[model samples]
Target chain A: MNLISEPGAGALILRVQEERIDAAVAIQFKDRLRELTAGGEGPVILDLSQVTFVDSSGLGAIVGAMKLLAPSRPLELAAMTPNVARVFRLTRMDSVFRIHATAPETALHVRAAG
Target chain B: MCAPPDDAALMPAMAPADCSALRGGDDCFRRNFRAEPLAVRDALRAAVARFARRMGPDDAGTLELTLAEVLNNVVEHAYAGLGAGPIDLTLCHAGGRLHCRIEDHGHPMPRLAAMGRAMPATDVACTDLAEGGWGWALVRSLTEGLAYRREGDRNLLTFEFRPACR
Candidate 1:
């Protein structure tokens, strides 16, 4: 898993480059998200534009990251591909997170609100 | 078309040869999965859906997903560690159920009990999300029935589901 992190407009944007979020890669996925989201870095934007698949195990890791970053910093989803989006929608988790269509727009919104 | 009650009753008692020959008024297709998994998946999906549609439309998506998940395991685990030989696939529909059987000339079938023992909590967060154990879990959740056996050099996995019941 590769994550390219940058501070944009005020929120931290995390671009994910991976094909799947499954049992084999969930641990690496969580650790990288944690590393990027640590120290209360405002609202974090996760760009899953490239992800093709995510299972329940993968979903749990993302939920765990969100819980860990909660109260201190909020986690937001952005630019989800169809397969990854199907997973979230299937699990009824799409309602739990603020999903934006793009990372920069999410960052700009957060910046304007903050 | 409606069959006579006597014929319907005798259907269950028919000889294995007779049953094998019976089409259940449906068509069948078998394919080899040595060349392309995606193409095999697409073809299998269409075939299974065609069978399911004869019963009803409600289960085509579920059947398609379950078949893909199990065949993916066949492709990923069975062929990865072992050499890739032809994976025999058969699709047949009878008695309101669609049966799919996948046979591979790979190692012995995976022990599901051992896999059950190895499953971590679903809530546990792993940094590496793509590795290990989830394939079997997905298969278990998606299919109504599963059976595995090894005869000689072939590992056979059979899965069955009723589209109408779904």
Candidate 2:
């Protein structure tokens, strides 16, 4: 699991560079998120444009990532594909986290206008 | 043609017969793989590829995700502490629904609690929200006809999916 971190304005954008984030890579994802955001002090927006699939374990890993940066920092999700969106809806986790329909910068504008 | 990863476990021998049933090259897929993450992933990719041309995108995605949930559970629970064991998966589409049967020589579920449980509570503090126990919900919501049985040393789980397109 390759995660690229881009420093946004007062926020951090973490991009998942894998096609699938299921049981095969959930632990790696959690460990990598911890490593990338160590000592970071801002809301982290996860860019899931490249992720085509995320199973229950992957969703748990994402939630774990959020709890890891709790109280001070937040982990947000962006650019959810249809399949990814379905998992969130079924688990009711979509309402728990802030979701974005577009990429990082584009979602910012969409949120502002809508 | 290039074979999928972990081709040794896939039994695509019936490919020609399966193709004769429908317009595309899918009606059944069978594989016997070790209950491990990478092996499960390979089986899923192969199954999706075999059925992709017959179903719509959402149905295809549904199949992959639901199968992942079921297969993952089998690995984490049934095969726990017993090392990776063999899992048999057979998928067939007929009468406008996809039928799935998975078998393994692992622990039998005590009561088939997966389909009986409700979704975990979502109305909670951010810090208190549950992270796991969500797979069963997805599995139940995505498929139907959930049944489980243990025959001798093998455990059989049967389920069905009604394609939204049908």
Interface root-mean-square deviation (Å) of every model: 18.2, 14.5
lDDT digits (tens) for residues B1-166 of candidate 2: 1111232221111112223223432378899999999999999989988877766667778899999999999999989889999999999877767899999999888657666788877777667767788777788888898888889999898999876655
Q: Mind giving the per-residue lDDT tens digits that candidate 1 earns over B34-68? A: 62454545555567656644544335544554565
How well does candidate 2 score on lDDT at residue B76?
A: 93
Worst 10 residues of 1 chain B by lDDT: B7-16
What are the chain B TM-scores of all models?
0.67, 0.82
Off by over 4 Å in 2: A105-114, B1-26
- Scored against the true structure, residue B131 in model 1 reaches a CA lDDT of 31
Look at candidate 1 and tell me the lDDT of residue B22: 21
Q: What TM-score does model 1 achieve against the real structure?
A: 0.53
Candidate that would win on lDDT = 2
Identify the leading candidate in terms of TM-score. 2
lDDT of 2 by residue, A4-49 (tens): 8888777888889899999999999999999999988988889997
Query: After superposition on all CA atoms, what RMSD does each candidate show versus the true structure?
Result: 14.0, 10.7
